[model samples]
Target: MFPLSTSINLTLPIEDPILKFLLILVIILAAPLILNKLKIPYLLGLIIAGAVIGPHGLNLVLRDSSIILSGTAGLLYIMFLSGLDMDMSDFKHNSWRSLVFGLYTFCVPLGLGILAGHYLLGFPLYSSILLAGLFASQTLIAYPIVSKLGIARDKSVTISVGGTVITDTLALLLLTIIVGMATGNVDDHFWWRLTLSVVLCIVVIAVLFPLLAHWFFKHVSDNISQYIFVLALVFLGAYLAQLAGLEPIIGAFLSGLALNRLIPRTSPLMNRIEFVGHAIFIPFFLIGVGMLIDYRAFFRDWESIEVAAVMILLITAAKYIAAFLTQKTFRLSKDQRTVIFGLSSAHVAATLAAVMVGYNVILGYTPEGEPIRLLNESVLNGTILMILATCTISTFATQRGAHNIAMGNAQESDDDRSRRPEEHILIPVANERSAEELVAMSIMLKKPRDPNGLYALNAIDNRVEDPNVEKRARKILDAAASAAAGSDIYLQTLLRYDVNISNAIVSVARERNITDIVMGMHHMTPAVPGIAGIPVPAGPAIGRMAADVLGHSNITTFLYNAEQPLSTVKRHLIVVPEKAEKEAGFQMWMNRIHQLARNSGAKIIVFAPASTMPYLRTFGRRRPANIDFVVFEQWDDLPSLEHDLRQDDCLWFVMSRRERVSYHPAMSRIPLYLEQYFAGYSYVLLYPVQAGPGDSRYL
Candidate 1:
C-alpha cells in the first residue's frame, strides 16, 4: 500500500513528472466541472484552482520548466485561434478601423501608465517607461468566452483581433527597446539588427509560410499529418519571432494568418485544433497564470498596497478610455465598446515577462542585503495582484458584453427571417474518395442551423451473397460521417438493401424530406467502337446511373467533378442560364454558390446574359463583396469557354431538367462539351429544385 505521508516532500512539489502531469490532467478535467456549479466562469475557475494548488497555496505543484513551456504554448494558441477563426472578409473591410483602434488602445494605456508610474509610484524614468509598456500590452484571456457565446464571427470580434495584432506588436517592440537600453545593448548596430531581422522574419512568415502550407495541404491527404504540419509551422514561426526580437505570440498569430485560407472553419482539422486547445493547452495556461499569484504579498506592506492599487487602476482606466475613444470614433454600440475594453484590459503575458526582466536587472544593493533592482520585489508582487484583478475584471466585462450581443443577434435574426424552409440535404456515398469530397461540398451548401438536416445514404446489394457487401457500405458511411463531423456538422447515415442504388437514394430522400442531393460525377459512360475500333463514349458524358438519378430525383441536385482541392480554388467561374431566375430554385442555387465562395475565400466571376446580371448583382450585394459579372450571351457555345478557363478556377454550370423554366435545347449538349473541353478542370452541374408555391423558401 502507498503511504500518504511518504508522498509529502517539503523540498519538492510532485518530483515525479508523471505524477505532476496526472495532477494537471485531473485539474483540467475537474476544476471546470466543480466550479461550474458555483456560477463561475470555467476560465476563472481554472485560474482560482491553480492558485489553490500552487506552491504559494497548498504547495501541491511547483512552477517547473514543463509548466512554463506548456503555458507559453497556450498563450500562443490563444493568439493563433483568434487569427484562425477570424472572418477574413470582415477583417479586410475594417482594416482601417482596426488601425485606429490599435493606436487608441496602445497610446491611452501607455500615456496613463507613464504618468501613474512616475507620479503615483515615484519610479525612475526607465522603470516608469517600462511599466507604461506593460500597461499597453494585453492577452486575449476572455476570447474563449466570446467564442463559446458564438459571436466569434461578429464584426466587433474581428475589430478586436485586428487591434490586438497592432497593439501587441507595438508593445513588444517597446519592451525590446526598453530592455536594450537598461542592459547597455542600445547602439547603432542594435538598431540595424532589429530592423533587418524584423523585416526578414515578416517576409518569411507572411510570404513564404503560406506558399509552403498551400503546397503541403495540396499534397498531403491525411488529417493527422495535416494537423501536425500546422503545429510545426506555428512553433517554427514562434522561434523565428523570438530570434527577430519579437514575442513568440506574434509569430504564432502570423502563422495562423498564413494558413487561415487553407483551413476552413467547417473542416475537421479546425475542429481538432479547437478541441485540443480548449481541453488541455488553455487550461494549463490558465493554471500557470494562477500559479504566478502570491496572495500573501498583497498585504505585506504599505508599498505593496500602493503599487497594486495604482497598477490595477491605471490598467483598467487606460484600457477603458482607449476603448471608449475608439467606440466614439466608429459610432459603435455600447456592447461592442465593452467587448473591446474587456478584451484589451488583461495584462498577463507580456507584463509578466517585462516584470521579470525588471526584477532581474540589478542596479544597487540595499542595507538589508537585498538587491535593489530596477523594479523591486514590491512592484513584482504588485504585478501579480494586477494580473489577477485585471483578468477577473476582463472576464466579467467580456461575458456581460458577449451575452448581450448574442441575445441582440438572436432577436435580429428572428426578425429578419420571414420564411425559413426546413432544409435537409442528402448525400449518397459509394467510395471513400468521393465520400469526403461530397461531404465537404454538402457542408458548404447546407444551412448551418438546421441540426437534423444532413444525411448520408448507403446502398447495399441484396442479391450479392458476399458478406463484405455490408462491411464495405458501413465503411463508406463511417468515412462520410467523419468528414462531416470535422465541421461540427452531423451526418445521419442510412443503409438500405437494394440492387438499384439510385432507387434506394430516392426512397431515402422521400422518407427523410431531403431538400437537396449533392452527388459526384464518378460514373462514366460505356464505350462504343469508333472508326478504327478505338473506344468512344456511346451516349452523353454522364453514365446511365447518374441519368436515372437526375430523371427520378425531385429535389435540387448538384453533380460535382473535382480535379483539385476545392479550398485552393481562386475563382468560381459561374455560368448561369439566361432564364435561370425564372426557375423556382434560382435563389437557392445562388445562395449555395455564395456559401462556397465565402468558405473558400474565392471570388465569384459570373458569366451570364445581360438579363441575368441584375438578379445576380442583387444577391451578390448581400454577401461578401467579391463578385465580377461578364455580359456574355453565347453560353451555348460551351467550347468557347475553354480559353477563359484557368488551372485555379472552378466552373459552375447551372442547368435545368427537361421542360423546366431554364431548360433549352442547348442544355442537352453541355455535358458532352464539358467532357471534351473541361475534362481536367473542377466543375459543378447544378440542377435546381423545382419548388412549388408552398415551398418557396429554404432554411
Candidate 2:
C-alpha cells in the first residue's frame, strides 16, 4: 500500500459547489447500476462512494455547509417517511409486540455495548453509557427494499417498524441525557424542562398538527399546494422538536403520524411526498454519511480496526439475541426472525449523531495532563466501519428473509398461487363525465387483498398533434384518478398517442398484465350512405372502439351504461347465460359481482339455469355475499327480467364472447333488448375472458 502522506496529497479538494453537486449526482446515478451488477446493495454502495470521495480519502471534496444542510434534510426525510409509510392500523394492533421487541433490541445492545466500551476498550463510565446508547439506535435503511417487494404490510415488517420508533426514541433520549451530563448541566431543572417541553411538543404535534392538516386539506383545492403544505408541516414539526430540546427527527416522525389519516397511503399527495424524498433528500443524506469516513484511518492505526471489529461483533450479536428471543416468544418463523434482525441491525443517523456529540464533549483529563475526549478519532473511524458492515449485513439479511417469507407464503396455498397473479385492472377513460364511474367500477371489481393498483389510460389519436388535446386527455384522466384517490384507491395515470384508442388500450393492458378492463359503453354514430354503409347497426349496439377492445382483449371486460350513479342504485339484477358457470373467467366475474354487491350494499338477484345456481350458491357460501338465485331455465327469457327490474336497479348481463363455451345466440340480442325494455335502468354487460380448460373449478 502507498504511504498515507502520498495518498492524502494526490487529489485536490473540489471547491466549486456545482462540481461537488455534479460529483454526488454522478455517484448516485452510477453507483447503483455498478453495485447491483456486483450483487452489492446500492445503499451500501452509496456509503462506500461517500468514503472514497470524502475528505479523509483523497481529500477530493470537503464536508461543506451545503452538504450538511442537504444531509440533515435527508436524515429528517428518512424518519418522516418511516412513520408515513407504516401501516398505522397494523402498527397499532402490534403495539405491544413492538414494545417487547423495542425493550429487547435496546437493552441487549446497550448492555453489550457498555461491556465492550468499558472492559474491552477501557472507556470511562459515562462515556461507556453514551456509547451503549449509540449502539442501541438503528436506522431502517432496508425498509425501502421491503416496500419495493410489496411486503411492507407483512406482520413481521409491521412489528419491526413499530419497534424502531420505541428503540430510537429511547436511544435519542439517552443521548440527550448523556450530553446534558457531560456538559455539566444534568440538574433537576434540566430534567423538568426536558419533560415539560417534550410533553408539550407531543401534544402540539399529535393533536394540533393533525387538526391543522385536516382543515388545510379540506380547504386546499390545488394538488401541488397540498403537497407543499404537507412538506412545510414536516419541517415545521422538525423545528418545533428542536425547540423542545429533542432531536428534529422525533418531530418529523410525529408529523408523519399526525397526517397519516389525512394523506391516504395511495393518494397522489403521498406519491409526491415519497418521490421528492427518495429522489433527492434521502440520497443526499446518505452521501453525506459516506463523506465522514476516512479510509486511510484503518491503515494508519490498528486500534481503529480492533475498535470497529468489537463494535460490529457486539452490535450484531446483541441484535441477533434480541431477534432470537422475540422469535421464540412470538413463535415466528426463522425467516421472520432473520428479517427483524436485518431491519434492526443498521447503524446510521442516530448513531452518528450520538457519536459526534460524545466526540465534541470533554470528559476528563488523562494521566499525562492531556484532555481526554469522550470519543476519540479511533472510535469515530470504528463507528464508520461499523456502519458499513451492519448496512451490508442488514441489506442481505433483509432481502433473503423477505424473499423466503414471500416464497413460503406462496407455497402454502395452491389456490392463492393460481388466483393471485398480481391483479392489475386497466380502465380506458374516454368520456370525461363517465370516467369517474368507470374507475369506481374498476375499484369495486379489484381484488381487495391485492397490492396491485389501477391504471387509468387516456389515449389521444395520433392524427391530433395539438398539445392541447393531450392536455385535455391528461386532465380527464387526472379527474378520474382524483376520484379514485378519495376512496383510498391507487390509480396510475397513463397517456398514450395512438392512431386507434382500442389498439392503445390493448397494448397497455398486455404490457401491464391487466386482469380486467372496465370501460364506459359508447354508441356508434351511423355512417353516411354509400361511403361506408352501416356495417353493423349503430343505434342500439356498442361503439366501434368498445367492440374492437372487447374483440381483441382476452382479459375480462365490463361495459357500463349507467342510467343513474352507481352509488344510488338499490339493487343488482344479473342475468347469466347457459353454461356460464363452465367458462374460465366465471370465478373472476363472480368475484367481481360479489365485490360490487358488497361495495354498493345492493342485493344481487341472479337469473340463470338451475345447474348454475348450485355453483353460485357455493361461491356465495365460500366468499360470503348477499346474493339470491332465480332459476330462469332459458337463455332467451332474459327480457322477462324487466318485470322485476326497477328504475333504480342495475341490470347486469353476464354474456360470453363469440365462439366461447357460454355464448348463446340470444347474446347478440342483448343491446336491442336493453334498449327496448330496460333503457331507463342502469346496465352492465360483462364478457369474461377465455380461461384455460382446467380453470372451470368452483374455487
Candidate 3:
C-alpha cells in the first residue's frame, strides 16, 4: 500500500524518491512524443521539459544524487555512442583534416574566450585561458541527427566527428593544467605524472581492452551477457581514464573505439547498445542538464545575463569562423559547412565538467577576507544559457543541413529521374545469421526520400508447419525489424508458410509491387543444370533458391555473400560487363553501388568495357564528392586482376538475367572463379531489372 500526497502544487517540490522517479519517467515518456507531434526535435523537447519540471520552474522535482549519477552516465553514453558510430576508415582518411579543424575550432574559441574574460569580465590571464578552453570544447549533440539522416559517412561529417575527439582531449588537458596551477601543483613533476598516466591509459585501452573483449565475445554465448559485458567494459574504460587523470567520458569513448571492429554496425549487439542509450541514458542526461538552470538567477543578476550573452556570441562566432575556413580549404558545399558548424557548436560534457572544476578553485581573497572562487555563479549560469542556445542551434542546423544534402544527392543523380520515386525492397530472410546484415545493406542502398521502406519476408516450408518453425521464422523477421529500427528505417514484417520458397517470395514481391529483392547467398550450390533451357555451368553454382528467384522474377535482385564484416571493407572492385550500360537496371545498380561505397567509406574502381566507360563515369559524377571513383577499361581481365585485390577489398559483380543484354557467358563462371580466387573477400552479385517485353536486346 502507498500513501497519497495531500496536495499537488505546481511549485511544491516532490522529495519522495518513488514519486520523483515516477514523475520523471512519465515526463520522459510523454514529452518527446508530444513534442514530436508538433514537429520538434525530441532532444530539445526533453531539455525544455526538464526546465519546466525542475526546482526553478514549477518545482515538481528537485535535483538529487540519482539525477547526478544518471546524468553522468548519460554524458558518457553520448560520447561512447559517438565513437562507436564513427566510421573508422573515414576517420583515418580524414585524420589530417580532423586535426586541422581541431586546431581551428580549439584555437579560435580559446582566443576569443581569453579576450572576453580579460577585458569584459576583468578576469586574470589564467582564469581567462581556462574560460577559453571551455569555449573550445564542444559536445556532438547534433551528430546523432546526421547519423539518423544516413549521411554520417560523408567526409565532412567524419572530419567533424574526428575533430570533436581532438578538441575535447586538448581542452581537458588545459583543464588539468589550470586545476594544477590553482592548487599549487603546477611543476615539472605534475607534468611528468600527467604524461605517464595518459600514456598508460591509452596503451591499456588501445591494446588490452580489445584483446579482452575479443576473448569474451568468443567464449560468452549469452546475448544478454554480451550486452552487459560491453556496458561493463565502457565503465571500466571510464574508471581507468579517471585513474589516469583524464575525463571518464574520454575513457568511454576510447572503449567504444577499442571495440568498434568487434561489433558490426548492423549486428543485434550494436542495435541493443544504441537502443539503451537513445531510449534511456541519453534522455536522462538531457533532462538533468535542464535541471541545472536556475531561471531566477538571470533576473536577479544582470551581470550573469550579460556574461551568458557574450559567451554565446563568442562561442557561436568562433565555431562558425572555424567551419567557414575549413569549408574554403576543403572546397566543401554550403550545406556541408553548416553540418560541420552544427556538429561542432554545442557546449556540453567537457564544457560543464571544466566549469564545475573551475567553480571549486580558489584564486584569491576578497576585501572581507572571504575566499574568492575562480568562477562565480554568474559565469556558471552564463555557461548553462550558452549550452541551451547552442543545443537549439545545433539541432535545427543539423536537421536542415542534412536534409539539404540528401535532397542535393537525389537531384544530382540522373539515374534517379528514370526510377520511381517510391522504392519497395523485399528482403528474404532465410538465415538468421545474415538477415540483419542483408536488411542493413538494403536500408543503406535505399534512397533517403523513398516513401516505401522495406519488406522483411520469411517464407517457411508449408508442409512442415511446426509451431516452432513458424516461431523461428517470426524471430528472424523480428531481428530484421530491430536492425531496421536502429537505422530509423521503416520495416514491414511478413511471414508466410509456403511449400515453395521461391514462389512465395515472387508472390509477395509482385503483390507488394516490390522493385528489388535482397537476400543472402545459400551455402549449398545447385547441381550443374540448364535454367529455362539455357546451359549453366555446374561448378559452385548459385543456390537453387536464388537461381529460381532470378529465373522467375524480372525484379532487380542483390545476392550478398559477406565474407568479412562490412566495417573492414576499404575498397569496392565492381566488374561491369560489356553492354551493361544498356541494361534497364544499370543506373539502379550504379546508385546502389555508390551508396554502398559511401556507407562503407570505401573507394570504388569500376572495371567496365571501353564502350561502357562514359556511362560509368556519369554514374560516378552522381556520388558524394568525397567518394573516390576510378574507371578502368578492362571488363575481360577479371581473372588476371585477382592478384591486385587486397584482403579488405570487396569484389562486386554486376550481373544480369539469362538472355538479357550484358549477360555474358563469363557471368556463368563467376561462382567458380569467386570460389577459387576470391574466397577470402567480401562480394555482392547484382541482377538488374529485366527490360520491358517490347525492348530490344543485342544478345
Candidate 4:
C-alpha cells in the first residue's frame, strides 16, 4: 500500500457538484431518444455510459455519494409502477391457466438453481437458496414490450401480465423468509414477527389505504398536490418497512397496490410517475448495473459459459412444465400454450437484484474484493446471456407456432398422425345480441391464423317438446353450415321440456366439450298481451339461471347483438376499471374482440388509465400507448383527465355501479346509452358484473 501523502495540498480545488450533476443530466437526456432510434433498449445505453464514467473507468467526476441511494430509488419506482399495473380482475376471472403457469415459474428454476448452486457450484445452503430465489423472480416487463410490439391488446398479453405478478410475488415472499434465515435474524420469535409483519401489511392495504386515499382524493382537488399525497404514502410505507427491518421495495409495492383499488386506472399521477422513473431513475439504475459488469471475469472462468447454457435450458424447461401442468382446463390452442411457455421463460433484472442482495448482504461477500463475488459477476453475465438467447428464441417460435396452431395448419407429427383423433370447432349460432357476441368471438379466433379443418354447430333450443325437434334443429344447423361454406358442419337441435335454459346449455357444453361458446345478449322483458300468451326472453341472454350454471367452468363466453347484421368487427376495445369486480367482464370482452380481430384481420386497441397524476412523483413515468382499450372508472369533462381521448370511432363500456351482475336493475338502462352510440357508428358496450360470488356485492 502507498504511504499517506506527507504534504497536504490544502489549496486543491473541489469539483463543482452542480456541474457534475448537469453532465449526467445532459448525457441521459440525449441517450434514450438517440439510442432508441437505433432500435436498442435505452437502458442498455445508460448502462454503458455509467460504466465508462464510473470509478473503474475514467473516474471523471469523483464524488463520495454511493450508487445505492440512486439504485434503490429507481428499484422502488419500478416496483411501484408495477403495482399500478396490478389489475388482476381479468386474471381472477380467467386465470386458471395463468395460475398454473405462475407456479411453474416459481418452482422449476428455483429447484434447478438450488441444485446448481449447492451440488455443482459448491455453494453453502443459504447461498444455494439465495440462488434459487434469484431464478424465481421474473420481471413483469412483457406488457410494455408486447405493447411496443403492437400486441398489447391480445389475450396472451393479459395472461402473461397476470401470471408474472402472481409468480413474482410468491417468489419475493419466499426470498424474504430465506433472507431472514440467512441473515441469522430468524430466532424463536421470528415466525411470529414475520407473521405479524405480513398481517399488518395486508391489513393496512385492505382496510386503511382505500379509506385514506378516498378521503384524500375527495378533499384535495389540486392536481399537483395529489401527487404529493401519493409520495407521502410511498415514503411513509417505505419508511415503515425500513423500521421493521424489511425491504422498502415491499412497502412501495404494497402502497402502489393499495392505491390500485382506490385510484382510477388512468390517473395522471401514475402516468407522471411512470415517466419520471422510466426517464431518469430506471436508466440510472441500469447504467449502475452495467458499471458493475466485469468483462474480464468471463475470460477467467470458461466453465461459467457452460453453466449458463445448462441453467438456461433447465430454468426454461422447469417454468414450461409447471405452467403446462396447471393449465389442464384452459383450452388453449397448442400455439397459445407454446407462447405462454416461451414468454414466461424470460427472467432478468429481478433475478440479478435478488442474488446481489443475497450474496452481498446475506453471504457477506463484496464484489470488488479478492475472491470476487461470483454470485454477482457470474449470475449477472449468466442471466443476461440467458435472457437474450431465450427471449429471442421464444419470441420467434411462439409467434410462428401460435399462428400455425390457430389456423389449424399444424398437423399431427408423423408419429402422432397415425393415432390422430378427428378435431372439430363448435360454433353456437345466435339470432340475438348475446348470441351474436358469442359467435363474434368464434370469428375473432378464426381471424388470427388457421382456417382449414374448422367446424360450426348450431344449437336450437325450443322449450316445448316436439316430435319433429330433430328436423327443425337440422334445418337451422343446415343454414349455419351453408353460411360456413359447408365445412364438415354438425348441428344439434334439442327439444326439451325444461324451461331452465342454463341446464340445457350446460348439458350440451359438458357432453360435447365444445371448444367455445358463442351467444347473444338482448333485453329480456315481458311483452304486451298481444295474440301470444307466452312471454319470451329478448336478446340472447340465457339469463342469470344459465350464466350461473356455466360460470364456474373454464369455457369462454362471447356475447353479441344478433339483431344487428352479422359483420366482421374491424376494431375492438377492452375497458378495464381500476376497482372492477373480481369477475369483471373484461376478459369475456377481450376474448370476443380477439376472436373478431383474428377473423377480420383488424387491429385491436387496449387502453388503461394511468393510476397516478401528472404533476406528482411516484413510480413509472411512461404510459402504455399500445393497448386499444382504456381502463377507467368514470368519465367526466375534466380536461386533464382522459381529455386527450376524445377521438371519434371510440367505444366505451360503462361498469354499472348499481347492479351486482349483468342481471341487476341498472343493466336494463344500458340499451339507452347503447342506442345513442349505435347510430354514430360507435358501439358502446355495457359489460355488467358477470354472474358470480365476487366483489360485485360491494359495487
Candidate 5:
C-alpha cells in the first residue's frame, strides 16, 4: 500500500487514503523506536526522516493529499498536548525565579531583536516592533523532554522546569500585548486595554473554567471522552483568545491549566493522551517542521545567515548577563546562575509559530509575487534554522552544563567527608519493640565489622550526670557481651557535657574505625547531628546511628537492643557454579562463619550443588578442619542427607549462587525455594556474587 517503488506502485494499484494513512502511521511508529535505538534525539530523527520522504528529498510521498491534512492535524494535536504538559503547580513552586528570569529573557531578546531589525536590516519601526515581539517568544515544552530524559530525580531539573512554565506564560502575555500594539490597532489606550483584557481573562478563568472543570471531572468517566473534552477545550480556548484579539495558543494553555487542577491525580486520561501524543502527533509535527525547510534559501541569503548568527550570540549573551546579574544580586550560587541561563536557552515551537505569524499575517511578508520575495524567504527560512539550532543546542548543552555546575558544587570536600556520618546511632530507650529492633539491627548490620572489631558504646546524659546512668548502661553492656560470647567486643563510656549523645557516639566511631555500633534508645540532647554528627536527646537514636554508620568503608551495621538475642544468623559459603571468589561481602560473611565454627569447636559441613566444584577449590587453602563439604546432584535429594547432618550435630550450611538478572544472578530461585523448607534446622545462604561493579545490585 505504501508508494515504495514505481514497479510495485504501477503493478499493485492501491487505495490512496489507506496508503497515505499507512505511510504516515509507519513513519510515526517506526521513527522513535529506530532513532531511540541509535541514541539520537527522536525529534531530530523524525525531521530528517520527513525531509528524506518529502518531495524535495527522496520524493517517496506527496504532501498534496491526506498526508498534508494529517500533518497539520498532528501539529495542532502536539500543541494541545504541549499545553496540557504545562503544569501550573510547577509555576507556583518557582514563581519568584520564573518571574525574574522570564522577564529578563523576554526583555533582553526583544531589545536585541529591535537592534537587529532596525539597525542591522533597516526595517520600518512598526514592522521592527512586530519582529522583536516574535523573536522574544520562547516556548519550553519541558515536561516531555524531562520525562524522556528521566531526570526528574534531579532537583535542578525540577526547579528549572518549574521556572520555565512561569517564564513561558509571562513571556506569551507580554508578546500578545506587544504584537497587539505593533499591529497599530490600539491608540494611546494600549496599556489600559491590555490591563483590562488580562484582568478580565483572569477573572473569567478564575470563576468559570475552574468551577466547570471541577464539576465535569468529579462526575466524568475519565476515559476517551475525557480526552476528547480536553481536546475540544483546547480549540475553544484558542477560539476565545482569537475573539479577545490575543493569540489562540494562550487560551489553549489556560484551558490546560484549568483541566490540570480539575483532573484527578491518578486519571487514566493523562496516560491515554500521552500515549497518542507521544506515539504519533509529536514525532509527526517535528518531522513536518524539518520537511518544510528550504535549504537553498538558507544558503543563498548570506546576509540573513550572518544576521541570524549575530542574533543568536547576542540573545545568548544577554540571557547569561541577565542570569549573572540576577544571581549575583540575589546572592545565588554559581550553580543556580548556570541553571537560570540554561532555562533561559529554551527557544522553540512557540518562537517559530510567532515568527511565522508575524512575517505572514501581520507584516505581509510572503515568498510570492515580484522580486522573488527574498526578504520574506530569508526571515521564514532563517527563523526555522534558528529555532532548530537554538532548541537542540540549548536543551542538550544546558542539561550538561547545569549538571556539571550542580555536581561541582555538590562534591564533598575532605572537611565534608570528615563530617559525614558512618553509622546510624541508636539511642538506648525502653520500649515494647526494643528487642525486635535490636534483632533487626543485628541482621541488617551483618556486614563484617572493622578489623579492630565492634566498639560497644554508651553516653552519659548531660541533664542528670547521674553515676547510676553509667551503672545501668554497664549492666546492659555486660548482658550484650555475654550474649555475643565468642565474638570480639569492646566496651567504652563517654562523659558528656551539653553535646548530643548521638553526635558523640558517631564522632567516636569514625575516629576509632568502629565497624558496627549498638546504643540505647533515649534522647538526652537537643543538638541534631550535622552532616557528621548524630541526633541528640531522645528515643533510641536509631536514625542518627544509621546515618553515622552508613557510608564509611564497606562496614554494614546492626542496631539492636541490649535485651534481645541475635536472630537467624545464616552465613552461607556460596560456591559459584563454575567461578571463584566474587563479592567481597560474600567472602567476608563465609570467612567469619568458618572462623566462628572453628573457634567454637562446632563441626560445619558445606552441602553444595555438584556444579560448584571449580569455585570450591579457592576455599581449600584456609579451610577449617572441623568443616567438611559434599556436593549434591539434585535439590529434591538434599533433604534426605540434610536430616543425617542434623542428627550428627553438624551444622549444614547450604550455599547457592544465583545467575544474572539486573545485577542479580539468574538461577537464584533454586536456593531461595530450598531455603524455605529448611527454615530452622539448616542455615541456607543465597549469595548472588556480583560479577563486577556493574553488577552491584547483587551486593
Candidate 6:
C-alpha cells in the first residue's frame, strides 16, 4: 500500500456544486463496494457514509436543496419500485394472510405506542395517538436487500410487500385524521370529504392509470420514451394522492399496483427501470436519510436516550410479536417469520412523515416559552436514532433470513439433478424492429437465470468485401443485445464473415452447442425458377436462409413473423401435426409455447389430431384448463383456418423435415401455403429437433 500524503491541501466543508456532486458519486460508488467484503450490508455503508460526510458530521457537504430533491425522488422511486416489482401471483395467493399480517403489525405497535405515550411518557390524547401512528407505520427500507438477493418473489417477501400496502395506508390515514382533530378540522363534512376523496383516488390510480398505460404501450415502442411515461405516471399518482389527502409515497405504490400486469418481469423496460432507480435515485435517498443523523444528541442528553430506547423497544418488540402471530396463523416456517419481521420492523417513510407532521403541528406554548408541539425536540431527536438503529437491524435480519431460505432452496434443487439440460438460444436478428420483438420473445422462451444461453448473431457474407459490411452487422447485433440488456440478461453477440451466411450460422450453432435458433421471417433471395414453364412461385414464405437453416440443422428452430408486440397478443393457436406427439422435440416445443402463454396471460387453442390430445393433456397437466382442441387432421384444409387467426392470435404451426417422425407429404408444401394465406398474421413456424443419437435428452 502507498503511504499516506503528509500535506493537507483541501479545506473543510467544500461547497463547489460540481465537486460536491462528484464527491457524493464517489462515496456512492466506493462505500458499498468496500463494505461488501466485510459481509456488512451495503445499505448500512451508504447511511454511515452520509453521516460521516453530512452537515452534522465533518460538513464536507451540506444537506442542501439539491440533495433533498434527489433524496425525495429516490424515496418515491423506491416506493414505486416495490409496487412495480411485487410478485402479484404470490400476493394474490396470500392476500388474506397479508391483510391479517397488516392488521397485526399495525394494531400491536399502535396500541403499545398509545399506552406508552399516555401512561408511561404522560403525553395527552391526540399527542399519544400521533405517537402511536408513527410506530404503526413502517418503511420497506430493506426491500432492496431481498430484491437484490433474488428473493423478492418469495412467499414471505411478497406477503410483506402486500402488508406494507395495508399498514402504511392505514397509518397515513390515521395521521391525517389525528392532525385534523388536533387542529379542530374534524367534522361531519370532513369525514364525507375524506371518504369521497379517497375512493376517487383509488379509482383513478387503479383504473385510469392502467387504461392510460395500455394506450401508451400500444402506441409507443421506444424503451426510453416508455420509461419516461412510467415515471410520469408514478409522480402523477403521487400528486393526485396529495390532492385526495394522502402522501405521495402511497400514490407511488398504488400506481405500481395498477400498472403491474402491463409490465413483464423479463422485459427490457423493467430492466431499465431498476437500473436507473438503483444507480441514482435510491442511493441519493439513502444518503440523505443518513445525513439527518446527529449521533451527538444521543450521547449529550438523557431524555434523547430515554425516548430513543422506549421507541426502539416498543417498535421492535411489537413488530416481532406481529410476525410470530402471522407465522403461527399462516403456518409459515421460522425463516419466513424472521423475514416478515425483518421487512416490517424498519421505521422510515411513513414514520418520518408522521414525525414531521407532528413536530410541525404547534398547538400552543409551554410555561418556559419553548413551543409546545405535538412531539417535542427530545422525541424529534429520538426519531433520528430510531431510524438509524431500526434500519441497521432490518438489514442484518433480512440478509440472514434470505440466506437461509436460499440455501434451503439450493438443497432442494440438488435433489432434482436429473432435470433438463441447460438451454442456449441463438437468435439471428433481421432488423431493429424485428430484433426487439425477437429478443423479447426469446427472453420469455429461455429459462429464467440462464446466464450463458442467450446469443444474438449477425453473419455477414465474406463474398461482399466492403469494409462497411462488418460495421452494419455489428449494429444489428448490438440492437439485439440492447433489447436483452434492458431485461438484465447478457446477450453474447457474434459478427462473423463467411462465404455462405447459412453455413456460417450452422457452424456457429455447432460451436456454441446451441439448443434452439430463432429466425425472423423476411424475403431473402428468391427461390430457384419453379416448374420450367408455370409462373415462378412467389419468394419462399420463410426466408431462403431460414429454410436452409431448418434443413441443414436438426435442432429445434422457430421462424417468427411478428406483426405486433408480443405483449399485445391475446391467444395462441397451436396447429400440431398428426404424428407430432411422437417427435423428439415435442415436449421441448410444448414447454416453450406453454411458457409464452403463461407469461402473456394467453390461452392455447390447439388444432391437432385426436390421437395427439392425450399427450397434450398429460404434458400440460400442471397448467390451468385454458386449452381447447379441435380434430384438425386434414392438412389440405389448413388454409381455410385463416378465419381462426385473429389479429391478436399467434399461430404455432408445427412441421417436420422429410422422413422425420412427424413428417407428412403435405408438410413439404408448407412454404406455398404460408406465403399464400398467412402473410398478414403473427405466427411461429416450429421445426422440432429431429430424433437422432443424442435427441432423447428432451426438456
User: Which has the greatest TM-score?
Assistant: 1
What tens digits encode model 1's per-residue C-alpha lDDT throughout 46-86? 88888988988988899888888899889888988988887
- The global C-alpha lDDT for each of the candidates, from Candidate 1 onward, is 0.82, 0.80, 0.80, 0.52, 0.49, 0.82
Q: Comparing 2 and 6 by TM-score, which wins?
A: 6
TM-score of each: 0.91, 0.66, 0.78, 0.49, 0.50, 0.85
Question: Looking at candidate 4, what is the lDDT of residue 535?
Answer: 20
Clashing pairs in 2: none
Better of 1 and 3 by lDDT: 1
Q: Which stretches of model 4 miss by more than 4 angstroms?
A: 1-16, 52-67, 86-88, 95-98, 141-143, 146-158, 179-188, 239-247, 302-313, 316-353, 360-699
Q: How well does candidate 3 score on lDDT at residue 382?
A: 86
Look at candidate 3 and tell me the lDDT of residue 674.
Answer: 85
C-alpha lDDT of candidate 6 relative to the true structure:
0.82
lDDT of 6 by residue, 96-213 (tens): 9889999999999999999998998888999898999889898888888887777777789878888887898899999999999998999999999999999999999999998898
- Sort the candidates on TM-score, descending order: 1, 6, 3, 2, 5, 4
Candidate 1: the clashing residue pairs are 268-486
Model 5: per-residue lDDT, tens digit, 228-262? 77677766766665566455556665666556534
- Screening candidate 3 with a backbone cut-off below 3 angstroms (N, C-alpha, C), the clashing residue pairs are 462-498
Quote the lDDT for 35 in model 2.
Answer: 90
